[model samples]
Target chain A: MTAVAGVAMANEPISPIAPVKEINLAQVELGKKLYFDPRLSKSGFISCNSCHNLSMGGTDNLKTSIGHNWQQGPINAPTVLNSSMNLAQFWDGRAADLKEQAGGPIANPGEMASTHTLAIDVIKSIPQYVVEFKQVFGDSEINIDRVTEAIAEFEKTLITPNSRFDQWLLGDKDAITATELEGYQLFKTSGCVACHNGPAVGGSSFQKMGVVEPYKATSPAEGLAAVTGKDADRFMFKVPTLRNVEMTYPYFHDGEAETLTEAVDIMGRLQLGKKFTDEENAKIVAFLKTLTGDQPSFLMPILPPSTDSTPRPQPFD
Target chain B: MTAVAGVAMANEPISPIAPVKEINLAQVELGKKLYFDPRLSKSGFISCNSCHNLSMGGTDNLKTSIGHNWQQGPINAPTVLNSSMNLAQFWDGRAADLKEQAGGPIANPGEMASTHTLAIDVIKSIPQYVVEFKQVFGDSEINIDRVTEAIAEFEKTLITPNSRFDQWLLGDKDAITATELEGYQLFKTSGCVACHNGPAVGGSSFQKMGVVEPYKATSPAEGLAAVTGKDADRFMFKVPTLRNVEMTYPYFHDGEAETLTEAVDIMGRLQLGKKFTDEENAKIVAFLKTLTGDQPSFLMPILPPSTDSTPRPQPFD
Candidate 1:
């Protein structure tokens, strides 16, 4: 399949960015509730928010994700931040859209390990969810697709657009400090913009992390080789968005870098074939901090009990 | 300390409900951001909403909770639906208050398992959270207590006090159906009111599921006995608030009942010391549906880059 370059190489001819349908407020509300609801998980303890916590970066700090059996996952958790802009999902780019990605974890036997049938059954059991889903998706049969659709609708609303960089992009020269401005210039001059410039900044491309110096393969860190198993694809992974780079830490796919500066410096040696002076690195870090944007906080529910027990899946085994 | 009764039970008589401090909108906003933030979890895959989901009764609906390690928990996942009113935290009544409970899951080896100190350190590392906390807690040392208090404040806003029953209590007689009215009478006459009736309904007390009869236990369905180890408490569990009962299902502590009728029959045989006639049971169930309230839905977040990544206690060894 041809790769879409809506945000990557300028010469690649940006394909028409897929128009995202506006999310209905009602659907978003239902989806938001679903996002926080734990009934989606097989074990009931895990929810989408448990790992994609709102307090920290959208990604957890662990090198590899832990799932239902406490079995360690094979790779680091990807940030849900600006994930909507990505053409494909996961490091291997397995799922085609966020909706498809939503279904993966629920039935992964780890993560949520929840089944589509079980998820719908759980929602249908809740008279409230049943009503909401019917209202949003219509009286159509409730299934994993609808569940994914509703959640995707809600997730689509998780847009972190319009950061200070966006403001600068909009010609708000004062939006960023002079140091940050210089850092931005350095970023471009240093060739960081070759792949890292876009609406989502970096999600638009996939690149080998160590282009100048080959990335050493670790027993566990298969990188792109794990996805394609192509010798040339070694140490390649999806380039992450740096929109809120300041907040995302322990940078890199393996979470090996404890700070963004370290990651930036490492990238200079590996990807850019250059070196960043300490001051340059410090200024870039400062500029990245400015990229942080305002986001909606977690909204708690005002749930009233069903007057009676309603039909639902059994909560326990 | 003497246990207070009703809403009065929450406050020390001398202190007046502990002088419930108003939550800072800024802090609450910050906490809300934190709530949806995924970096708090070890895998960056789950967030607070993962389990205490807003859509499906503020619970994931599993008998046992799933965690970072993807391990199954030993008890039913309780709703964060109206948890602020819970006198203590967890089914075992392990935590004394919300502040204490907030940190529990984050640090529990079976739950988030994020260390309190590490959680603080992580948040502190984020310049925005540091700024937000300073503004919210007013320089009152940014630590676990402040974090919990901020989150708890946000949680307090999650009040489910607008049910039709509440409206009826406030003099809206037409708010309920005739069957619901009859069920209300049966609810009181059948003695379910002895424990399940109150402003928060059922949450005010702890009771045994099978009072007049002994019921066989299911897998991981030990009930409160697991906490207290008292013979009388073996089948006893927290009297869950039936406020959002219809939305929260897999009835009872173990979530064994899939339908309300089954739950009603079980409750009748065990707790009420009699069989529920089909008509009576139907009326009771009808009344339960009336307890369902109109909860506003959430606006989906437009996908944004999340910014938290501090070391949290790893759930898996």
Candidate 2:
């Protein structure tokens, strides 16, 4: 590893995002096929990649995702990139980990709308998938837990590493522009780094969306309160990772902030109770753009054809 | 290349499908990004891969494609695999080549529903795409022609080579099962090889869907009649490639035949005016399975993010 002077120091609040070094090749391969296979959905059209698109920075790039039957999701779809670093998955931190979170959307009426039993049946019916499951898990029995576990394992490998900011952190002084450097300094000094610190840059803990003042938005989500049913947890969401925040836009839980500049402005006013000049906002946006890293690269998995015995996808019915 | 007793001889009707030998790397790379980039669609949720999915035998695996606003398309989507081998594009042969065909769905109201002008506008606004276009095309100018041309270049490389049948034809006697070999002999003697010949096994010419009997289908498509404006061309459609026919199920122009057996049975009755026994149909299906070649392999392209200046996708509108 390159030695840096000021950044990634022992006392530094944030750490450099690390690249995946090792994983079970068989499990990862199986998970990738399942991730792209849309037959898991009721309509046979929605895969895990449909919402968390790897082609577009692990997001669908919509304000809120278009789900089953074109139902608009209540909250913005979070980026699956580097999500393992988060305190928990989802804005509410409802699921404790990626494994638990993987099962939610498949059964959600507005999302994939597939029962766990149906999803398992679909996978089990495919001979190739069945062979793979037996090879990976040492048994032919397919279940929701094993399915989600494999998916989560694949999700762990979705981290983006070697960003320009990461380069600068690892002792390369010329990695970032002067404007971006200024923005980084301002970002830390302005107290934005308090919650938004870690390898993922924000997923370390939960924080209120509006700290100093109340946030006004049309979204009806109660954030952590929805999970805990506690009045105090209202508006408390897991702080989203700022890594690759430029691409994963229409920011925040509600997706009300369409641009980085607007999101920065809103964050300053509602969270920190401070207003930033246009110049500063532009610099921050520029700095945020530098967070885009090398995305995951792998051959697109070829899914096995469904057999006559396989339950057909009832798209219309 | 291997020598076989009778198959792949100079006088043989069938030829082996060859792998892509040459291509422009830059153009293919850029085209791949565009193919998977859903931002080209009105909803930012549909791309070339949506209907002609790489994961699912280069098809959506639907009877008819689900298009923009959930509108069901008029005809079944043809497989993009080895489509360049076709005499022309689309079932009706309306578009002259892959390049022409690439632009159709983008603007089709029921499909992607994005006009050429709007699609160009979207691409032009993304700084990264602009830079890549200039690098690949050697110009700053972005247009529909160049866009489609690049996409067509990529499609040319999507050929599936080295199928078991091809191996058997290349003189690997054990490559195929005995039943499959028997079916191949039956296929040739039964005159099924007349239209389904050449490397792609079918795309060399256009043929009447029902040569001896009227085909019963609900699709209103008049096949080549729409292009030629002639009564004789009413049921004449471009012969689809039998390559990977096992995966490209729900066969026939209208996707009315849901299985290989059903399709084989229909073709026997309609085109040849002969009925195949159950044993013969099973053997043919087994032979068809041998046509599933090695699928194309490439890293999934990471698409450039849409900029703030880019027009936002009007999914609901």
Candidate 3:
């Protein structure tokens, strides 16, 4: 182990976030419009931005989301920022990718609450949307597949790069403070890094919410069991990314913890069976706060006006 | 009469739309963030943009707006574009200016449903917002007065200029077609210009909906009388701006006319006691469409994160 320990690897660590990469301009723009357009929902008031708001760390900041008909979301909304790095989509990791996840919320009874047929029909009825779909897909047809594809393309660009920790990892010595460095050392030495180690600092795999202690969550979600139907998978949930964790508040699947310090304490006790000193918790929180990087910036998209043929929104019965 | 009528007027006519003028950058930026931030509402899901959406001709395109707890609005929302030119605010002209109008919806029971105290407390809790308020107001205090002022400053920049009609009015004779020119002539000769004349093509004065004929409306709104508490002011409303009229659908205070042709037909029949031919209605409608102008474009403002001190939103009672 000592003989190979000092050798430098050829490949750089992926945890240090990278800058914006190549993207399809047309698809991203089309997807951006769809992301902001609320007509895709039955109520026509809740857009993708309504839940995954880019303005505030790509989250609604509520303990749980307020969905269609003001129904409470089953779980705390995971941040959409840097979500492309997740192994799978949703807390249960039920969906394979963002494309699959994009289609779920629009038709979910507690979410946007609109069927694919109705959403497609609304898009088809708008003449400008028809033209835009033709421009992007080279076809007049506007369907769920094309819609999700465009939205997923847009989601890929929502990466937040150049955090202080990332800068430190990229060889800038002054990017992080000495306290923060000590906190980083503790983070790696502790069992916390076992599951939370990738570019997203988590989300590389599904892990049980509690290992050393049982968690009595108020939310009735069964986690991975709902997807796999296996008793062993119960309470197994996708670990959320720690990138921009400062801004994405009310942490954890149930969102019972309200602050980063509270979340840290709860996680350490439940997941690691360790009691962190107040100073240790403060240092770790300070380190986590440095993960907030540059946010995605773009003009609020101008949506097309509905024509006479466009189906009117049924906001209330 | 001939000697006095031939003299050229020195003061410019305020009917033809002009380009966007000066704006306060810092205040507008602060206000833009507030305009898009939903925390101003009790539900933390509605913003100024929810109803006055700049993306679609500064109107929500609903027959009436869906407000707090899904309560339906009493009157159709007026387009915010070129609203600074309006003599007063709201369909009933209750608020004296944009600044006065900005505070109404935030506290209105059926609208944002957030009290002034709660909204101020929420903003004050965010350190970044405190800094922003300090930057704009030369003081650290954040209040309803300051909030409304900043919002009004931003709303002033919502003007839509450089329309085809504006280009024509500004000496580009070829900008409009022959039919459009005929429509403009009819607009002046038929006395429509008496109420619908200005840089905004309307919004200059309060006018009765039915001038020559008694008109029946489905909406129970009493218009100006609701504010003035006078029987004579019944059905009197501020003439809505015709700028981007094509995009502001379900026209008039009642939002009963679903099409521009229908709107024109109703206006002529009720206001002037004239029955316009189909060709005349088409020409008038075509001219109105030329009023569609450049929309306001800017990066969506990233909102500051809420702190522990920030009051949580109470969407449901």
Off by over 4 Å in 1: A1-41, A44-57, A95-103, A106-156, A219-230, A296-317, B1-50, B84-89, B92-96, B103-107, B114-130, B143-145, B218-237, B294-315
Ranking by DockQ: 2, 3, 1
Compose the digit string of candidate 2's lDDT tens values, residues A1-317: 44445535555666778767777778888889888988989888899999999988898889888877777889999999999899999999999999999999999988898899999988888999999999999998899999998998899999998999888887777999999989988888888899988899999899998899899879999999999999999999999999999889889998888999999999999999989999988888888888888888899999998998778776666
- TM-score of every candidate: 0.79, 0.97, 0.94
Model 1 lDDT per residue over B1-317, tens place: 13223333232111111222565667566665566554565555556766666656777655556666555666667777667777677776767777777788777766676667767777776666777777876783688788888777666655665577655554566877888889878887888878776555666667776679987777555566777787777766778877777766657766667668888888888988979899999998887766655553444332233333545434444
After superposition, which runs of candidate 2 have C-alpha atoms over 4 Å from their true positions? A1-8, B1-7
lDDT of 3 by residue, A232-313 (tens): 9999999999999988988998877889999888888889898899998888888888889889999889998887787877
Best by lDDT: 2
DockQ of each: 0.28, 0.79, 0.62
- Per-residue lDDT over B1-317 for candidate 2, one digit per residue giving the tens place of the 0 to 100 score: 44444545556677778767778889999999899988789998999999999998899988888888777788889999999999999999999999999999999999999999999999999998899999999989999998999999999999998999888877787999999989988888888999999999998888998888999768998999999999999989999999999898789889998889999999998999989999998998899899999898999998888878999988888
TM-score-superior candidate, 1 or 3: 3
Residue-wise lDDT of candidate 3 within B1-317, one digit each (tens)? 33322221112232455555677789999999999889999988889998998877888887888898878888888999999999999999999999999999999989999999999999999999999999998999889999999999999998888888877776666888999978877776767778887788899999999988877888999989999999999999999989999889879997888888899998999999889999998888888888888889899889998887889877767
Candidate 1, residue B139: Cα displacement in angstroms equals: 3.4
lDDT of each: 0.66, 0.89, 0.86
